[model samples]
Target: MADSTGKTDKDVAPQIQATDVQVEKRASDDESAEKGVFEHINLNKNISARIKNPLADLSPAQVLRDVEEFANEHGLVDVLPALKKGALVARDPDHYESVPDMTPEDLTTIDDEVTHKWRQPRRLYFTIILCSIGAAVQGWDQTGSNGANLSFPDALGIPEKDNPNAARNQWLVGVVNAGPYIASACLGCWLSDPVNNYFGRRGAIFGSAVFCFIAPIGSAVCQTWPQLFITRLLLGLGMGLKGSTIPIFCAENTPAAIRGGLVMSWQLWTAFGIFLGFCANLAVKDTGDISWRLQLGSAFIPAVPLLIGVYFCPESPRWYIKKQRIKEAFESLRALRNTELQAARDLYYIYSQIKVEREIAGDGNYVTRFIELFTIPRVRRATLASGTVMLAQQMCGINIVAFYSSTIFEKANATVTEALFASWGFGLVNFLFAFPAIFTIDTYGRRALLIFTFPQMAWTLLAAGFCFYIPTESRAHLACVALFVFLFAAFYSPGEGPVPFTYSAEVFPLSHREVGMSWAVATCLGWAAVLSITFPRMLAVMTPTGAFGFYAALNVTALVMIFLWVPETKQRTLEELDYIFAVPTRIHMRYQAFKVFPWWCQKYILRRNVTLEPLYKFDGVQTRGDNRAVKE
Candidate 1:
């Protein structure tokens, strides 16, 4: 493929052979005599007829040269196959810098940025709407059971004061909530890559929808508490799928610019669902027989819409690209953006860049890729951070309120209506506060919010503990506890709630994202199960003062650990962070440089009051180097 220059394909091929770049050129480069090699690569027509301008205005030679050096340095050996020996030389024998034909190597320079966007994209308005709905469904499922517990005591024929099976029933409901998480944590990690590889993102959603429908009906009809318990467990399996798939689906469907906003919407809507469930509790008066059953069965309402709507929702474009379904990816991008083929060309170019990175990482398969996450130090750090956040979120004592607020309020001597209203208030605060994270997460960055929040939560809890310890059983003590609880939700809904999911999505290699998310969820569920099982007894044994104090202590410890360990992950695309972890460096420096700043600010620099545009997009390439280079 030599042209007038001395450049050759081999010179520009990726540092390694990549499996995804096989091109079926509909129109030959020679046929388009006036077009240059890079031009032909960008303009070639397909079924969707997309045309993109590459590193437009920059020399193809420079682009290819940069990509080659970058790949070689990064150990991206799989991309080498994309090159032909004469790609650069074939362009122009007279001009040594020329590139001939679109050597796949030339496209690898943007691999990190391209793949990260596709894998964890900036979501659209409609897609955000759907994910928010999904989050709401999760919230409903979690809180719906809480309301049922009130009417449930009679419906299940159990006595409040002397029921022998009370512990079992509590476990049944709580465990069912936990069951889905367990299955999702295990199965999600185990099967995420395979299911994603074979069925695409749409398939996982469809499967989740089907199971969601089945699980709710099973819960609606179960005659015995154990049967109800079993049904709940089954329900968890389905919800587990939703939990693991939702983030992946949202991340892949979105664009880089709006990635955090889209993903954080999951937490916001989860609060909305909880609030809705609390309202439902207020509406459903407990009749002696069927009150709890009907309330528990209410999950079917949202389940129906999700099942139907998901059938029509688009498959994730990133998943399409990963599967090497180019035309399908273009079609999805076209529908998502509602744009012409020109936009799709750029999308495919982005897809090509991602494909190169995936191949370089040698993660096209599910099994080995997943195992490699734990084996690799950088990925393990991410996995640990994700687990830490999940633990912090659970131990923050918010779930204690969601799951046991009524009990706690009742113990504090509030009337039933007061308790229910208090629960509603809790949900309201969570839902309202969640909205801020959608804006602040990418602006303030994950680390800053956490650094600010956890300490406040710690102080609030300590104050609440003191108020409880005071001799006066004054209304002010209850108010103090209430205030602390609200602050816990407010800080947590934004920082702890959303950041963990965002971190989970971005931290691992794409090949292992599913499993990594699974492991993270599993860790979350493990802690949740421990908390749920022990919470009743812990409260019984230690009383409210001790439990609040213990949780407060956990919060303080978590604040310290996060300050020391949790890396900031605000604006950096998944690709850029992967590379940062791939080598050793000051995590905070990389965090500050790429992950923390607002995107617009990073594009320009303040040099003595004169703004200068950065030469490179900060998507994946590091602006500075550090210690981990020693490993190489």
Candidate 2:
């Protein structure tokens, strides 16, 4: 400035220096601003590129991570958060815009809101409670038959202690007791898909409730073992339908956040039913002929409530969506969720997933669709996982305890009175331990629970078997066997008992959900049939110790299958699991063990600042196709 105005040389030099400093500062600021602009542009471009071709060279874990980061950068949240901030709203009366494409993370976020909302005492909980009443009937039917075994033989004119036809009588007992499972496996499983597809989840459940009512009444009136067997066979048809449909209903209607617990409530109530059955048996054990009849008839109580209540319950929104009854789906969702925004969000996610599924299915017939379970690698994996878990549940010998606990106690040298009371203890343990799963299942995840508990179950079964080696006259031996049996129940209730049903409910895609569940349930019934038919003979042949050992071996096998095959399904949307299983089997087989420990440590011990990136990656080609049809 001084140079231009013709000032002194010293003044001009100082002015020049100040000008230089200001110019340098301005240039540096310009450079930093340009750098920020470039960095932002790069980040946005990267995200867009990933979205455009999501499956291109990305692992399933990487895809999940990228989608989550994208949601965060865009200021996304789940249903509750969006609703509180007014980011989500119902469509205008005149014109409606389609919902935008959502990642599985976004879908799961919406599910979280619905779940949190349902946790309050609301219509959703009421529906779950009502639907679960059928499960109580199932439990009652199961243990009621076990209690009847105490006296039904004599009532049927079969010998009590020293019959020469003990083998034939044993066969009669097993066939009558397992008649339902046999019917379920052979006929009911085949019918489940068609029934659900034709009648919808609510209709299927209602029909089952009716059959449950009729079957138990028939059993109470039956005069012959053969007549009782036919009634049980009819009951099995009802059970098969309920088993396949109820879990699907609960899963489709409830929020994914609490879906595990709610669907698992089926098992919880089943435990309660077992408790009721034991109490009923205690009340009638001393009665001569009426004891067995009354025990069989008691099943009618829960069925009445189930039949009446399920009629008033909302149908699964997913079923409505599948039928393309979009308006009804929205209404059903609204009834189940807290707000219109939540319902809309859920509908958006569900619709997107259904579209993807239909595209894959391509107007296939029922037989073709059923065959797809095996032909499609991803779905086949799901089928295998579900079936294996069900098989494992049966083979672990929980039913052995459930069906013959009184006999087991007798074998342990307890009197009839003591055995009946001890049976009550077994039922109590089964009921009490199921509560922990209600709390921990969504938090700890399914795989972790299986891993932790399977080993414990194996140990307990083995110990119980070994305890039988001590003389039956030894009170200490009897006590040890009883303690081990109780411990087995404790481990099983929280893990295998509930996980199989819940996990199977979740694994299948909406397209094949009913059929897939049917197959899974069939596997359960098939195994149950084999065990029920053989266990009495097994008891006569192998004795209690050898039978327990066989169960222990099965548990060990189950543990291995779980470690190798099952993935962590916590906090994931049902659609997200498709990608998870799409990961190559070889990669999972190699890295599974190392992946297990860190996941457990992070959730249980680390508590903060834990990274789980390495646990999910492997050196393998990405098998998931570039199916970004939802984005369009």
Candidate 3:
């Protein structure tokens, strides 16, 4: 039978057997050589030979040229197969390349194994759960502060009802509460790279957990708004670290088939934390002075288990490989994967990619590494995609509802008690809608979801805004506003909510992942800071109707950006993305609608007679359907 690449079993089997015999003969010769009085000397020579690093001496361009020359001279179909069969090795004696187990059909088998092993092992599930809890703590902080803001004004002597300084106090409320995003944008973004590089993923998480644990207690006991603001700012630092680390940690560890959904658990648990925060508000809304403090302090509760549990989880195998702790990487992969073969295959892929990246990056410093994001075409495309998704996520106005829902409800003429309960309902809708993403994100793809749901979100925001034109005190108007808010959550939750985090996490190569994710998170927090600082003023000047209309316009802009730029990543291994982004911009945009629209329509609306395939594939040197091979 022919394999997926159309080579028959008979045509491939003998070559594989020949390669195996050659490898075995080499091993036998080496073993025979080591059995003499000169054995220790021979061993030392072998060790020295194996210690040389190919990437240290070669430029990326030179390496690429050498690989192409080697392939051509050997008449090889692909570099990987030759490398696997021991036909290709670095010229220097000290450079090492682990030969993967080979059959002539090994490539096809590897692809099949990757697909079959798509489901991660149970230990990986524990890692996902641990990272998800860190995300929940972040989520808890997001809406937990919203709840506390409601009562803290009264308890802390800030002006509210008829005070002349109410406008200033409102601005202060927005700014102080927005401190986390600001801190994340400024310090957390830059810190994430070095912290992850030096401390490892688990260590960074532990540090964040300590900050998360302590900051909330300060918020709980602070008697003054300034004290509370300082505590919240510190909390933002922890959040910034968690925001940068957890998604990368999760994405690096997961199988490609479920990577999107697993990374998106960050947002899923964020919504859950918001739900818990809203419930806390309802529980304490009627209590006297301590209500807000207790609500804010409750964010600390999840950090305990997060700190303890993360210690037991495996470090990212990719990170271990990057650090050249090959033994640890192997053990970690074994711990997280279904079988030893699968682990070996994963290691082979990671090792190959790391070699290429090291040659390309060339012992660059952090600043040089950051500059490479813009200088490298594939890396630049990924950075732009990640940054745009994050910006779109913040501009979608989800945070307006998340952070200011209680105030918005009150503005609609619901009593404080009624508004707190209504906020709970809003949080519930968000939490419930997030569940659909877990099932659909991998199957339906990230770009399609963003395209399909964005316009729906825009329309709901417009309708919700128009609802405010009804008399403020009318029960019908209040119900209409609440209904539209719930609809907005429904539309936003399944797509835009999770796609940003997943897309950002998966886009960067292992070499630049931490810095890339940090930049993406910084984009998210920077825009969030803009929204949080401005939403109160916008609400005052433009009315709720006009503010919602403005956000609706931003959603339309985001839709245009996504359509023009973002590529489908579903079912593609993270390594394959190098080729995906290499597709020229004009070609990608021209074909994007054909790729994204049919899938969205069939899955959500039509449900029949649709066949979907990846927009691009690499066959030997060629990109399928395109005449020219993609040169990397």
Candidate maximizing lDDT: 3
Deviating ranges (above 4 Å) for candidate 1: 1-58, 61-123, 151-160, 163-177, 186-191, 338-342, 345-349, 470-474, 585-632
- Decoy 1 TM-score against native: 0.74
Report the lDDT tens digits of candidate 2 across residue range 341-373. Answer: 567556655554454344335546679878988
Q: Report lDDT per candidate.
A: 0.59, 0.73, 0.74
- Range of the 10 consecutive residues with the lowest summed lDDT in candidate 3: 36-45
Please write out the lDDT profile of model 3 over residues 93-126, one tens digit for every residue. 1112223344435443333433454456789999
How well does model 1 score by local distance difference test?
0.59
What is candidate 1's lDDT per residue for 1-632, written digit by digit as tens? 33224445455454223221233222222323333333222111111112222233224444455445533543433443232222232222123223444334433322323333333322356666665576665677666676666655555555344567766555554554455555555553355555666777667766666766677667767776667767766666666666677787777666554577778777887788888877776676445456566656776566666766765667777676566665566567656652332233334345444643453355545666666666655566677777778777777776777777766666665667776777778788888898888878866777777767887777776666666664446776566667777777777787777876666776665666777777776666667666765676666668887888888888888876676567666555464455334433244334445543444354444322333433223322222211112322
Q: After superposition, how far is residue 529 of candidate 3 from its true place, in Å?
A: 1.2
Model 3 TM-score, 2 decimals: 0.79
Question: Considering only N, C-alpha and C atoms within 3 Å, which residue pairs clash in candidate 3?
Answer: 49-93, 49-94, 52-94
Order of the predicted models by lDDT, top scorer first: 3, 2, 1
lDDT of 2 at 212: 87
- Residue 596 CA displacement from its true place in model 3, Å: 7.2
